[model samples]
Target: MAFELSPLDRELSNKTINENGFSVYVSGKIKIDRSIKDIRHPRCKGKLHSSNLTTASVIISFFEEHWETLLRTVASVLNRAPSGLIKEIILVDDGSSRKYLKDELDNHLATAYPSGIVRVIHLEQRGGLIRAKTAGAREATGEVLIFLDSHCEAGINWLPPLLDPIAANYKTVVCPFIDIIDANTFEYRAQDEGARGAFDWELYYKRLPRLPEDRYHPDEPFDSPVMAGGLFAISAKWFWELGGYDPGLVIWGGEQYELSFKIWMCGGRMIDAPCSRIDHIYRKNSTNFPKAEFGDFVGRNYK
Candidate 1:
């Protein structure tokens, strides 16, 4: 089901689309000042357990992203995740032209980080998503490295479950189930069942089906083979050894497949942890990006 927008929502949406070429502009204007109490899945609660010793550094990268939604992302992590498990939060700005994301964000965050646990790094050149994320990953000092979209909200107790897999084997890359948050109304929604990421020969990503027989227990992890590029957690050591993301890639699209293949080739496993969750604002763009940049993804030479 889609979110119903009110008049205020419509106004904000129109303003946002004009700026970002999508609905995230509306998310920027949204005030998530108070905690989002009900956007959680029923399964997220009820006796959740996670590894306390497995600490992590959450990295978020963005270019011209919304402000309010970004802080909500950090706030959700702070409010729900165990303090000891979160070593730090790193925000990387890929040459954002926006004024607020710079000093305004730094100043705003200055009061927030007394111990210097959270930081904002600015790049002079616009290094697309892949490079920008790599910049954040380079600064990570935790055992597990988590990469989250700048416009996402953390689900209750999400970090521990993602780290649980890596603690078993450093070669595991674990991702939480993603919930949907409306771009216009900011309404949160969850899927009835769980699915994993897959891709076609055309290089297009799709949601694979889930089977009940695959589960030995209600909260067990499933093999995704691949995961959405926007969100996932991997061992810091393995991520660096596997070469983080392909530096040859520019912007977005093909990087997910590139990283997925590298993980499989190197004897690493990718899992979808349903017990952990996060809400993402699925970006929608009516027109395709410039062909010069993204055309290679669909070309016959993709093999």
Candidate 2:
């Protein structure tokens, strides 16, 4: 259900876009615990997961993220995932200058979840996304470490399929089939087609046709040479064994390819769990992010 905005509201939303690179006004209007479509394969509806899937610590790193969308992401995860399987939700603040993200965020989470499933880590300096995630992983206590962008909404039954594979083989890494969440109207929908993760010669992220065998078992996980990087689950032990993200890769660039290739070459595998769907908001415009001082960090990381 979409909200009808008044003329004044529309004007405000446009202004909000300039500030956050998305319609924060529209995101604020939507219920924090709003329901989204399941958007999974037909066979996924009745698929059974292991009764004893390992617990996970979901780590989301954000800097200057919109308040409403951030809250909604946590809400969707809490509402959809089984309480026992979620050891904690860690929000790593990458030195956000925004006042509201400071005390207000801490107070809200404390009041809303008295059981303390959510924790926030405030970095003294802006360590970029790569460092922020590594910081969050260092404090995680769960068997699995799940990384998600600050603006994603977990679809129905999104957790089990991801954790099940890791439970079977600790070396396996699983990523959800990411859907698209509209940046403007905040509409939730599926991506046009399903493709496996791949990369070209220049190390640019690319997608290839799903294997022919994938059609036979549409609900099962399939091999992906690389992960989209924004959302995925990995065993905490395996993640640390692989040394997490390279400390040298400042900000966001080629960490996806780095981690993906490392996983394959180091005798581990990456898969896209078909039954697990997570909706991500692809921004209509670039946010007012600070430029990284590190020169050619992308090229350096790829090298």
Candidate 3:
């Protein structure tokens, strides 16, 4: 007897067919008794092992003209990363006109690391950083997600510091101490005499001189007033649950400030680890201002 399927069951069946190319139907009832293994999608056939689940996804979002810097950043990550830690490096190209990034990155992936894990997502139109990050976040597959700027260079054992805190059940956001790179030459340098700092109401990020006692207690972990978005890690679930980065912010001014403040004000703590470090080149002049009109949005969001 062919029983009529309800709208809900029909919708589910359609989705399953579209996603897995197989639909579940019981012998006579509406219950779905088929195993996912029975799906006929060519990509679904495999002797899946649980060991493959230990992978991590690293996401980097960048715009035009940062291709070389991003390549160097990925190299640094691959060099210092522990074996069996990262599963994939996701590069979200926010409307870059450069053709070499795709060519160079593909060649490197083929010869250097052939895990078939390097994925590139190119947007047809330029979306700001928050949108780019959100797009990359939706496509990530690792148990843990680490976010880094396109121009960051990682330190030794950098992955462990970020992952360790989350593995120990810290749902809050984790960030490493960022050292600065010379804007002119892209050469890395130690933190300046006055480097550790946060953003003010004016949306300008400024550094303050380390306290005399700060040098004496270099080994101690302390609560930070804000987490720098250049490098931070969080469990995949919590990130989406908190609604991710606010999609309302424009190109690149105050999105980090909004994220840091959201994490602190909405029941999550931000911590800075002295043990982990990354170098970011500070551009003396940035051309990221979308419009003079959008400046008010920055003030309202951070104020």
Best by lDDT: 2
* Candidate 1 lDDT by residue in tens digits, 263-293: 9989999988887878887665532243464
> Mind giving the per-residue lDDT tens digits that candidate 2 earns over 147-213?
9999989999789999999989999999998888887778899894468988878877888889898
Which residues of candidate 3, in runs, are more than 4 Å off?
1-55, 192-197, 208-216, 288-303
The sequence of per-residue lDDT tens digits that candidate 3 reaches over residues 89-183 is: 88888776667666675676577657776777887877677788888889999877788888667865566656665665546667777876544
TM-score of each: 0.88, 0.96, 0.72
Which ranking of candidates, highest TM-score first? 2, 1, 3
Q: What C-alpha lDDT do the candidate models reach, one value each?
A: 0.78, 0.89, 0.63
Q: TM-score of model 1 relative to the true fold? A: 0.88
What is candidate 2's local distance difference test score? 0.89
Give me the runs in candidate 2 sitting further than 4 Å from their true place: 1-9
